[model samples]
Each structure stands twice: as C-alpha cells, then as structure tokens.
Target: MSQNYPQLDQATRDELVRAYIAIQQIYEEKGSIPKDSETILKRYQGLLETLGAIHLGLLVASFSIVLNFFIVNYILHLLP
Candidate 1:
C-alpha cells in the first residue's frame, strides 16, 4: 500500500532544509570537540526555541488569513 503526503511549498521546504543543515553543522562541530553536555544541550534548546517561534509565527499568519477572509466576507454581505 502507498501513502500520499501533502507537499510543502518552496519557502517552507527551504526553511526545513536550512534547519536541517544547521543541525548537521552543530553535530559536526560537536564531534570535533571534547564532549560538553551543557553546550550541546544549550545549542539544542536554542534551536528548539527558534523553531517554536517559527511555528508560532506560521500559526498566527494562518489564523490571520482565515480571520481576514471571514471578516471581508462579512463586510461584503453587509453592503447593500
């Protein structure tokens, strides 16, 4: 059986690629250095925060788009 997944737009795909590259670079750097759990944890935390912010921003943007659509339609219906 085959499963189909929704496609991401170019901008979203680029953002995901950038995030993946950043994570890979961090791992590469860590491998070359003496193990420092604190630093690695901090780096992961920072990345998680940044990704969380991006997710929040996208959520707000989507909500605003939907709200605007409803608001505009409501206004249009109000016009004689």
Candidate 2:
C-alpha cells in the first residue's frame, strides 16, 4: 500500500536538516549522542507538535465560520 506523508514547510524542513547535521557532527566527534543534543531534539519535537495543533485549530475555526454563515442565512430567510 502507498503511504501518504504530511508535507512540511521549508523552514521546518530546514530545521530538521540542521538538526540532522548537528547529530551527525556530535556522533563523529564523540562517538555517542550527547544529552544536550537529545534535549534540543525534544524541544524541536514539541515545537512541531504545537504548530500542528495550531493548524488543526485554524482549520476547525474556518469550517465553523462557514457553517455558521449558512446557518444564520437559513434562519434569516425563515423569519420573513
């Protein structure tokens, strides 16, 4: 089966690329992942999750607005 992937914006994609480079550099220099790098990655993950939530919220709000417009128009038409 084909899998669908979420499309990431350029800035987020660039951030991930930078993170990958940092991890690779740390591994090359120290032969293991450091605590600081792990923490930074975690923070990035949290930021991405928060952004996803905001997008979802905006989508829901826009849909509600469109629905409300139709509902109000229907009610108004029924009055006269």
Candidate 3:
C-alpha cells in the first residue's frame, strides 16, 4: 500500500529525532530539577510530552520503513 501520511520530508524527520534526543537528555538530567516535588512532576510532564512526540515519530518511521518497502516491490513487479 502507498504511504498514508501527508508531506513528511527528511528535514521534518531529522528535526523530530533531534527534538526527541534533546528531551531525552533533559529527562535524564535529574540534577537540574528543582527541590520541590511539584516542580519535578511538572518537569516530568514535559518529558512525557517529548516522549510522546518521539513515539509518534517512531511509529510513522516504522510504517515508512516496513510497509513502504513491501509496497514498492509489489508495484515494481506489477510494472512491465
């Protein structure tokens, strides 16, 4: 089958990966977190948002990587 997504070019993919890495780094650096538990929770929420973004990117990439290849080969075989 053909790709379902709109225009998701290489630059968009690269930016998504970069943002995901940056969010991951921030989440790992607990030392930078504030002393209050509430503040830490707030920071964690931001981290979760980043994680969600990363997860979405991975999902889209997987569709392109796995399904796209199969569709390409099938279409190529169909062509004379």
> How much lDDT does each candidate structure score?
0.80, 0.81, 0.79
Rank list by TM-score:
2, 1, 3
Cα lDDT of model 2 by residue, 8-79, tens digit: 766777788899998888886786766454676576997889999999999999999999999999999999
lDDT of model 2, residue 4: 34
Query: In model 1, where is the ten-residue run with the lowest total lDDT?
Result: 1-10
Q: Rank the candidates by lDDT, best first.
A: 2, 1, 3
Q: Cα miss at 34, model 2 (Å)?
A: 8.6
Q: What lDDT score is found at residue 63 in candidate 3?
A: 90
Stretches off by above 4 angstroms in model 3 are: 1-43
Clashing pairs in 2: none
TM-score of each: 0.47, 0.49, 0.43
Q: Per-residue alpha-carbon lDDT of model 3 for 1-80, expressed as tens digits?
A: 11644477777777888998787678667656443456655768988899999999999999989998999999999999
Which one wins on lDDT? 2
Between candidates 1 and 2, the TM-score winner: 2
Best by TM-score: 2
Q: How far in Å is the alpha carbon of 1 misplaced in model 2?
A: 24
